[model samples]
Target: MGLVVSHLSIDCTDPNALAGWWAEVLGWERAWDEDPDDDEVGIRAADRSAEWLFLKVPEAKAVKNRLHPDLRPPDGSDQATELARLLALGATPVDIGQGPEVLWHVLADPEGNEFCLLLRTPAQVRADGD
Candidate 1:
């Protein structure tokens, strides 16, 4: 069988708060429930085509995320716009070993999850030294 990505799960200190932060960042909406459980919260893409889940963990975040999500704007759009938007959503800038020549900017979520903003499109990611 082949594998396909379904959803991404993140562990955080506050599920509701992080979920809300992501919702604003992605322009998604939190799914409705009478009372969201203490351990989990979720946000669905505004069109309902994708979902992201956040789960509460007892320990503090201690290291960089080994895996990170890369976000890009549609073709013909510049990365500057996307960067500004993300910063407005509460993402903080991070150095993360990237040099000035790097094509992506490393950033941390409100809860310190490391993610990147890529200058290239998915179709162009196979090149070297990206």
Candidate 2:
């Protein structure tokens, strides 16, 4: 049988904090039995099919992420609304040479991990016949 995909791990200075931040961003919850001071922390997706694991590391993030998550707004939410909300939640805009004309916005979390907010929500994509 083929191997199954598990969690996506991220290295950060403070796993608990970063994981909490991401949980807020994704509307996920902290994994069961994970404490605020743990060196490794995790958040589970609403449906529990996916997880993001965060591990503590000594060095700060020094370079752009080679692998990053691309996020889409949920139903009833559009890209501009989501961008505004993320900015309010402490996510900052990032410039990764994705010039002005691109359809998505690049953003960095509080710990400097880069992720993208795509231009269209799933509802929009469906409406556009994409």
TM-score: which candidate is best? Answer: 2
Instruction: Put down candidate 1 lDDT per residue, 2-84, tens digits, no spaces.
Output: 98666789999989888888887777898755245668887898787788888899987899898888887646566788899
How much lDDT does candidate 1 score? Answer: 0.81
Give the best candidate by lDDT. Answer: 2
- Off-target runs (Cα >4 Å) in candidate 1 are 34-37, 120-130
TM-score of model 1 vs. true structure: 0.80
Task: Give each model a TM-score.
Answer: 0.80, 0.93
